[model samples]
Target chain A: DVKVTQSSRYLVKRTGEKVFLECVQDMDHENMFWYRQDPGLGLRLIYFSYDVKMKEKGDIPEGYSVSREKKERFSLILESASTNQTSMYLCASSPVAGKRTNEKLFFGSGTQLSVL
Target chain B: DQQVKQNSPSLSVQEGRISILNCDYTNSMFDYFLWYKKYPAEGPTFLISISSIKDKNEDGRFTVFLNKSAKHLSLHIVPSQPGDSAVYFCAAKRADTGTASKLTFGTGTRLQVTL
Candidate 1:
């Protein structure tokens, strides 16, 4: 079984504050992703890292950034938290595609961020 | 544009009945499809998947049927139980896009099972 752990399940921050959401996966997958889920909009990708120090912007990358200093850990950073940034954030990891197994994401429990 | 769409926002079914959740995609390039189940306060879990080459894939009580011509797929759960209640999301991906490619997801459908 794969375990993806989020550092915090719930977090609260004031407007203009810096916030960080951390994720760690035990399986050492090469690809890591960050996504935000909103009602009626579903899950939108924020950022993803294919390898250490390599990152790419996803559909909703504004106001957010990510870090992948190590294979097992990926971190999402909010430069300046705002009320609108409050939402559930999810982290997922998967092996490089084209392997014998199909591409399937293993996700963390998710962190609910509240910006006041 | 929303490449993948789960038209039904919600569905209700009774225990021991069959629940069918539908999803459609506009991109013909999508060669692989997946279904995920998400519980409140938790991340979505991979349920089942079907490739474009196959029409149906079954696992336990869950079965996914795909129609390549229509670019649509449906997940059917038989003998639905209370534990089956959750938000179901349909996702699609292009296999040739490589490892860094992300899956396009639909808005999701909330399924409720009542006894």
Candidate 2:
């Protein structure tokens, strides 16, 4: 079974602070993603990394960035945490199964971020 | 624009009954569809998926039916149990987007099963 681990399950930060949410996948998947889930917005992609040191902006990438220094780890960074940024953040990974991209994505438990 | 939509925000069903959750997509480019179930504090887990080439896919008690012409799909769970209560999200993607592509997701439908 594939395992995706988030470094923190819950985090609290003051406004204007810097915040980091880390995720690690054991399966060495080629693709990693960061998403934020809001009450009515569902899951909106923030950023995704297809390979080490390669990143792309998703639908909702403002005020957020990502790092993929290694194949197994992906990190989401908030330049300046704001109250509106408080939400549940999820990390997901999918392997490039041969030439065909994997359809199934395995997700982490999610980190609930509270910005006060 | 919301490419994918889960019109029903919530649904309630009794144990041993059949629960049908519906989803629709506006984009014609979407060729693959998927369903995910999520609990309150946990991330959404992949449930099942159907490709444009196939109309139906079944796994255990869950069966997903797709209508390519209508751009819609439905997930049916028979003999629903209490553990089935969760938020079910309908997602879709265009297979042409390659490995870095992301799936477009609907707002999600919360399913509650009563004993």
Candidate 3:
């Protein structure tokens, strides 16, 4: 079974503080993604990495950045946290694109971040 | 521009009854659709999927029906159980595209099953 692990389950930060959410996958998948889930708004993509050192912006990427230094790890960075940034963060991984078998994503438990 | 939409924000059903959740998409280019179930504080999990080539797909008590002409799809859960209560999200993707092939998701619908 594939395992996607998140570094933190709950985090509290003050306004304007820097925050980092880490994710690691053991399946050696090539595609990793970051998403934020908010009430009524649902889950919106923040950023995604297709390969080491490669990154792409999603629907709502403002005030957020991502890092992919190695294949197993992907990190989401909040430039300066704000109260509005408080939400649940999810990380997912999938096999390399273009393969029909790689359609589904395996997700981590998620990180709940609170910005006060 | 929201490509995918789940108009209904919430639905309530009794256990052992049928629960129907609907989704619609405006993008005609999407050929693949998926449903995901999520519990509070947990990541969404893959529930079921349907390809444009087929109108219906079923797995156990869950079934998905797609209408290509209407650009609409629905997920039906028969004999619903209380444990099935959660938020359901509908997603669509263009199977032929590679660069921007990420799935576009709907806002989601919360379902409650009571005894």
> Candidate 3: which stretches are off by over 4 Å?
B96-101
Task: Using DockQ, give the best candidate's number.
Answer: 1
- Return the lDDT, model 3, position B14: 98
Write the residue-wise lDDT of candidate 3 on A9-114 in tens digits.
9999999999999999999898899988887777788998888999999889999999999999999999999999999999998888667746677889999999
- True contacts preserved, each candidate? 0.65, 0.55, 0.45
Ranking by DockQ: 1, 2, 3
Model 3: which residue pairs collide?
none
lDDT of each: 0.93, 0.93, 0.91
lDDT of 2 at A23: 99
Q: Rank all candidate structures by their lDDT, best first, as comma-separated numbers.
A: 1, 2, 3
Error of 1 at A77 (Å): 0.6
List candidate 2 stretches off by more than 4 Å.
Answer: A97-101
Question: For model 3 chain A, where is the 10-residue window of minimal lDDT?
Answer: A97-106
Instruction: Kindly indicate the candidate among 1 and 3 with the higher TM-score.
Output: 1
Worst 10 residues of 2 chain A by lDDT: A96-105
Q: List the candidate 1 regions with Cα displacement exceeding 4 Å.
A: none
lDDT, model 1, position B98: 71
- Model 1's CAPRI class is medium
| DockQ values per model | 0.74, 0.69, 0.58
